[model samples]
Target: MAGPGWAPPRLDGFILTERLGSGTYATVYKAYGKKDTREVVAVKCVSKKSLNKASVENLLTEIEILKAIRHPHIVELKDFQWDNDNIYLIMEFCAGGDLSRFIRTRRILPEKVARIFLQQLASALQFLNGRNISHLDLKPQNILLSSLEKPHLKLAEALFGQPPFASKSFTELEEKIRSNRVIELPTRPQLSRNCRDLLQRLLERDPDKRISFKDFFGHPFVDLEHMPSGRSLEQATALVVEAVKKDQEGNFSAALSLYCKALDYFVPALHYEVDARRKEAIKAKVGQYVSRAEELKALVNSSNRALLQQGTCARDLLKEMARDKPRLIAALEVASMAMAKEEEGQDDGDALDLYQQSLGELLLLLAAEPTGRRRELLHAEIQTLMGRAEYLKEQIKMKETRWEAESMDKDGLSESVRSSCTLQ
Candidate 1:
C-alpha cells in the first residue's frame, strides 16, 4: 500500500505494482517487464533526498558486489536506473519471500529441514569467504526463499526462531555484545549432539574462539560436501560412473563407498532438478542405484566381518603393546567400543560417531609416535576404524532413504483414499 501522496517511480521498462517493503532509504515494489508481463522482478527505489555520503558509498559498494558476483543461491541484480528524484535497483524477485516470515509461519523447523537450510547458507558463505567478502548485515529477514513449495536459501540468516541473545533495548543489546557473555541455546526442541556442538562453536562469545568458515563448512552437521548446487548433477554423474566401473571390477567395498558418495550428490541433485521428466528419470536411476548399493552393502558387510575377525588378533597385540602408553590404550578402547556398538545391530549413527572419535584419537597418536611397530599398528587401527565408519555411514544413509520412500508412499495412499471418499 502506498501513502496518500506517494506513488511508485516510473521506470522505462518495468511496470511497478504493489509495494513489497520499505526501509529508511528505499521502498521495494513488485514489478514486471512492460514487454513481458510474465517476467517479474523487484525494484528498489531509493529517494535521492535520502542519500547521505555514507549511504551513497554503501549503495555503490552493493552495486559492485552484486554485479561482480554470480551464484545460483545469490539473487541477481538485473539492472539499475536513475531519475532526478529516485534511483531504482532492478533485482531478482523471490516468490517465497524472506526466511523470517517463513519460519514464523512454521513456528519451528524439523532438524532435517533446518540442516538443509544451514547447508545452503553455509555454501553461500563459503563462496563469499573465498572472495574475501563478508555479509555484515546477516539476519533471517535478509535471507530470501526461492519458492513457496520448494524453498532454497538465497542468502544468510538465522536458522531457528529469535536471535540467540535477547535484549530489551539497544543499550542492553550493546552491553551484552560488549560483555562477551556466553550464549545459552534453547533446549525446547531436542537437537542432535553434532547440531548442538555446531551451535555452541558458532555462538562462542569470543571472536577468537568462534568457529571459522573452514571448520563450519566441514562440520559434520553442515555437511556442505553433499549440499545441492548447480554442479550437483554433474558431480553425481561422474561419481556414479566410477562406482559402476568399480562394481564391474569385483571391488565390492570400493564400489559401495563410491555408490554411497555418489548418492550423497545424487539425492541433492534429485532435489536440485526442476524438470518433471528429468526428476522422474533421476528418481528411477536412483532406485536402480539404491538396489545395487543394497546388494553391495550386504557383500561389503560380509567382507568387513571377516576382516574384523582377522584384525582382532592384531588389535589385541596392539592393545598389549600400547599398554605402557595410556593415550594409545584409551583410543584402542574407544575403537573396541565402536566395534561392539556396530555388532549390536542398533544405532548405526552412534556407532559411526564413536568410530570417528576413535579414529581422531588414533590418528593423532600415530602422527606423534616414532617410526616403529607401534606407529604401524596405530596406522592399521586407524584404517580399520575409518572403514567401519564409512560402512556405518552407508548403512545410515540407506535406512534414511528407505524411511523417506515409505513416508512418501504413505502420503500418496492417504491422498488417494481421501480423493475416493470425496468422490463417494
Candidate 2:
C-alpha cells in the first residue's frame, strides 16, 4: 500500500505492489514484471517537481555510475524509465532488508559474523576504489542483505532516515561534529582486539592519520585473501597450480606457503560455490590439499629446526654487531621470545602479538639502517617473524572453523531431539 494520499506510479511492463521505502526525493516500491516470468524488483521513483538543479545533476551522476559498474557486492541497476511526473530506477530486490534492521534485531552480532560483514563491505569498497569512485553516504541502512538465512551484502543507495547519533537538536549535532572529542566505542558487547583496533583506526578524526584504503584492505581483520568473492575460485585454482609445481620440485617450504595461501582462497571458494556437486568436488580437492599441506608442514617444521640450529651462530654475531643499537637489541630479544613462545606450543595468540610487536620495531629500524650486513640480517628476521605470524593465523582460523562446525552439528542434533519428543 502507498502512503496516505500517495498513489503508486503506473509504469509499463511492471505492477507496483506496495511501498517498500521512501526518501526526500524518491519512493521505492516492491514490484513484479508483467510478463509470465514475473521477476521482482525495487523501483525508485523520483518526482520531477522535487528536483533542484544540483539534485538533478546528482541523480544523473548516480545513474551514470550505477549503469557503468557491475560487481557482486553491489546492487544491480536493471533499467530506468521516466514519465512526465516521475523517473524510475529499477534495481535488484533484496529480501533481507538492510543491515541496520538485521543488527537491531540481533542486538549485537558475534565477532565472527561482524567480521564477515566487514569483509564484504571492504570488498565492495575495494572495487569502488579501483574505479576512483566513493560512496559518500555509506551506512548500515544503505547496505542491503540478499536473504535473511544466509545474507550476502549489497551496497545500495541511502534511504533518508533518522541518523544514528542521538543529539537532541541540530545545534547539538553541529557541536558534536565540530568538537575534537574522541569517539568511544561501546563496552557492553565486548569486541575482539583486531576488531577494536580496526574500529579505532576507522574512527580516527584526522584524515591524514586515518587508515588508508590499501592498509584497510591488507588488515588482518579484513583478510582480503580469504574474503569470499566471485573470483575466489579462480584465484584458488591458480595458486593451487603453483603450489603443486613447488611441491613436485621438493621445495616444501615455498610449497607450504603457496598451499596455505591457496587454502585461504579455497575456503572462501567453497563458501561461494552453490551447486552441490561442484561444492562436493571442491571439498574433495580441499581435503587432498589439506593432507598434502600437513605433510609439508611437518617437513617444513623439521627444516626450520635445522635452520634455527644453524642460524644460532649468525644470530649471536648479529646481536654482537648491534650492541651499539640498544633499541635494535631489544627488538631482537622480543623476536627471540616470540620464537620461544611458539616452540612451547602454549599460546599462539600471545606469540603472534609478540611477533607483530617485534616486527613493527624491526621494520622501523631496518628502514633507517644503511644497506649493510646488519640491514640484511634485520630484513631476514622480519620476514621470518611475518611468516610465523601468518602460520599462526592459519592455525587459528582452522581451529575456529572446526569449532563452528561442531557447534552447528550439536545445534542440529538438539533441534532434532526436540522435534521427536514433541511428536511423541
Candidate 3:
C-alpha cells in the first residue's frame, strides 16, 4: 500500500512508462531515461513507511548485495533514488520471463536442456560464493532466460521485474503470472546429466552449506570431459543453444549428448584458478563436497527412482567416497538398497547387479563403522544381500552342472563312468 505523499518520482526528462508489477511491499514500473539518452528499465518503487526497521535493513542489504556483484548470470541493478517516502530501484528487465512459466509450458524439459539451466545456475552460485553472498531463494521463479528471439537480451531488459497484467481467471491468470517463459538453452553433452543435481544442491535449505559458484566450477561434473560439443567454452555455449532447438522438438538423447560435450570444454577453464588460489580454497572445496553430498542426499530423499534410473555413476561415486569412510559407506549402502528395490521389475538383472555392488561396498564400510546397534543393523542387511547373491550364484552353478550331466548322458558313456561324471 502507498503511504501518504507517495507519488512516484518525476525525473525532469525521464518518461514514466506503464506499470510493470505490484507486490505487497512495492510497485514496479517500466521507465525510460530521457535526458541521459534512451535507456529502458524496470523501476521498483518501495514506500519507506511500509518498511519496518528490519525491512529497511533488508532493503538496504539487497541494494548493497546487488550493487557489489556483476556476473553474466546475476540480475544487475542499474540505479537507485530516494525521494520522500518512495525509494525507487531501477533494474534490468528480462523479457523472456522467469523459469517457472517456462517449465509449465514445456512440461518436462529434455535432460540436456535442464542441464544448461543447471550450469547457468551453477555459474551464478559460483559468482555469489566468491563474494561471500548467498541467494537465499533459488526456485525456478527467481531464474530468468534471455529472449534472443527478438533482441538478444539487452543489459537493460535482461535483469528486472515484470510488468503488471490485467485481472483474469484464477487458474489461467495463475499460470500466466507464474510462467516467465524463460528459455533454458540446453547444455552440451558432458554437462547435461550432472547440472541439475548441482543447482539442486545450491538450493539446499541449509545456509551453512549452500552451493557456491567457486565450488560448482571446481567440480568434476563441470569439467572438460563433461561437455557435449565444441573445442572452446564459447563454441560449447553455441552448441548448447543449438541443442535447445533440437530439445524443443523432442530429440533429447541428442541434446543431452551435446550438453555433455559442452561441459567438457567449460570445466578446465576454472581448474587452474581453483588450484592456484589457496586462501579461499578450503572453504570452496568443502562447499563443493557439501553440495555433492546434498545432491545424493536429495536423491535418497526423493525416492530411489532417481538413483535407479541415473545408474551406477551416482552410487559408484558414493562408493569411492565410502571406501575412505565407513559411516558414509553405511549410508550409501542403505541408499543402494532403497534404489535397488525401485529398480526391481524395471530391470531385474541391473537391479541385482546394483544390489551386489552395494552389498560389496557396505561390507567394506561395516568393517570400520561397526558401532553397536548400527553394526547389528548393517549385519542384518548384509545377510540379506549375501543370501540373494548366493542364490544367484547357486542358480548359475546348478545350470552349469546340469549342462555337463546332460552332455555326458548324450555321449552314452558306460553307466559306471556316467555315474562317476555325474557325482563330480
Candidate 4:
C-alpha cells in the first residue's frame, strides 16, 4: 500500500518513462536522464512513511555495502536521491528480466546453460563470502539477467516476506527455518552430477557445515576453466598419440595409463570448448578414445587374472617390486590427488597429515627416479601440490581467526532482501 503522497511524479533531472513494478518497500520505474543521454536506469522509490527504524537501517546498510563492492555479476547502484516523501535508489537497468521469470517461462534449460548460471552464482557467492558477507537468501529468483539469449546473471537480493510455497502454511515454513532445515527445492533437471553435488553443499541445512567457496569452486564441475587449452592441447594430443603407440606395441597396461591421462586433459578441453562443431569433434574423439581405453582395461584385467591364478596377487607383486617404476609412479600420483582433495575444507588437522604422507611418497618416487626431463616434471608437480597444501593451511588459519571474532549464525538475519517488479 502506498502512502498518501504516492502520486506519480516527474522528479527533477530525470524523466520518468514508465512504471516498472512495486513491492512491499518500493516501486521501480524506467527513467532517463534529462540531458538527452539514451542510457536508462531503474529508479526504486520507497515511501519514507513505509519504513520503520529497522527497515530504514537495513536499506542504508545495503546501500553502503553495495557502494563498496564492484563485480560484473552484481547489479550496480548508480546513484541515489532523497526528498521529503520518498527515497529513490538509482540502479542498473537489466532488460533481460530475472532468473525466476526465465525459469518459469522456460520449463527446462540446456545443461550447458544451467552450468553457466551455476558457475556465475558460485563466483558471486564466493566473492561475497571472501568479503565476510552473506546473502542469507540465495535462490534463482534473486538472480537478474543482463542478457537473455546468452544469459549473464547479476546476483540481486532475494525478495523477502513472500511465502516460498503457496501450498505450505506459514507455520510450517517457520518450523523448518527454526530447525535449520532447507525448504524443498525446485527440480533442476538440467544439472549434471558435479553441479548437483555443488548445489547440495551450498544448500546444506546447517550453516556451520555449509561448504565455503574455496571447497566447491575447485570441484571438477566449476574447475573447468583450468582444463587443457591452446598449448596444453598439443600436450594432451601427444599423450593420446603415445597411448596409441603403446597399444600398437602391445603394452596394454601402459596404454591404459596413458589413455587415462589423455582423458584427464580431454575432459577439461571439452568443458572449455564453445564452438558447436569443435565440441562435436571433441565428442567423437572422446568416444573413440573411450572405446580403446575399455579394450585396454579388459586386456590389463585379464593379465592380472592370469597372475592371480598363478597364486601371486597382482597387488602383492607390485608391492614386492618397488623397482617397478611405472607402477610406483601411477600409485603415488593417485594417492597425491586424493590427499590434496581432502584438504579442500577447514577440517581439523587430518588433511595436513594426508598431505604430508602424499609428499613423502612423492619424495621417495622422486629419489628413485633417474635424473632427466621426467624427474624435472615430477619435481615441478610436487612443488605445485605443496603450494596448494600450504594455501589450504593458510585458509584454515584465516577461517579460525574470523570464526573466533564473530558468530556464524544467520538465523535471525535482518529482513532486507530486495525485489524488482516484472511489470512495466
TM-score of each: 0.85, 0.80, 0.44, 0.53
374: Cα error in model 3, Å = 30
Q: Which stretches of candidate 3 lie over 4 Å from their true place?
A: 1-9, 148-263, 266-424
Model 2 CA deviation exceeding 4 Å by range: 2-6, 154-181, 186-193, 241-250, 276-281, 284-288, 366-424
> What's the CA error at residue 120 for candidate 4, in Å?
1.2
lDDT of 1 at 285: 81
lDDT of 3 by residue, 1-424 (tens): 3567655567544666666567779987767888656877768889898999999999999998888777666777978888887888878766656665555554444332333344455556666776787878755656665542311111101112222222466787677556656323234222322444554454454556776655667764443233322234455457657656655675543444444443333332221122335313422432342343334333433443442345455446545644766666665665566455543535434545666777767777679764665566556656755654543333333232233323322332111110000000
Residue 199 in model 4: shift from native, Å? 3.1
lDDT of 4 at 82: 89
Pick out the ten consecutive residues of candidate 3 with the lowest summed lDDT.
Answer: 415-424
Worst 10 residues of 2 by lDDT: 415-424
Roughly what TM-score does model 4 have, to 2 decimal places? 0.53
Candidate 1 residue pairs that clash: none
Q: By the lDDT metric, which is better: model 1 or model 3?
A: 1
Which candidate should be chosen as best, given lDDT against the real structure?
A: 1
Model 4, stretches more than 4 Å misplaced? 1-7, 152-167, 174-191, 224-314, 318-424
- lDDT for model 1, please: 0.76
User: Candidate 2 residues 170-221, lDDT tens each?
Assistant: 9998887677988777664666678778877876779999999999999888
Shift in Å, residue 361, candidate 2: 2.8
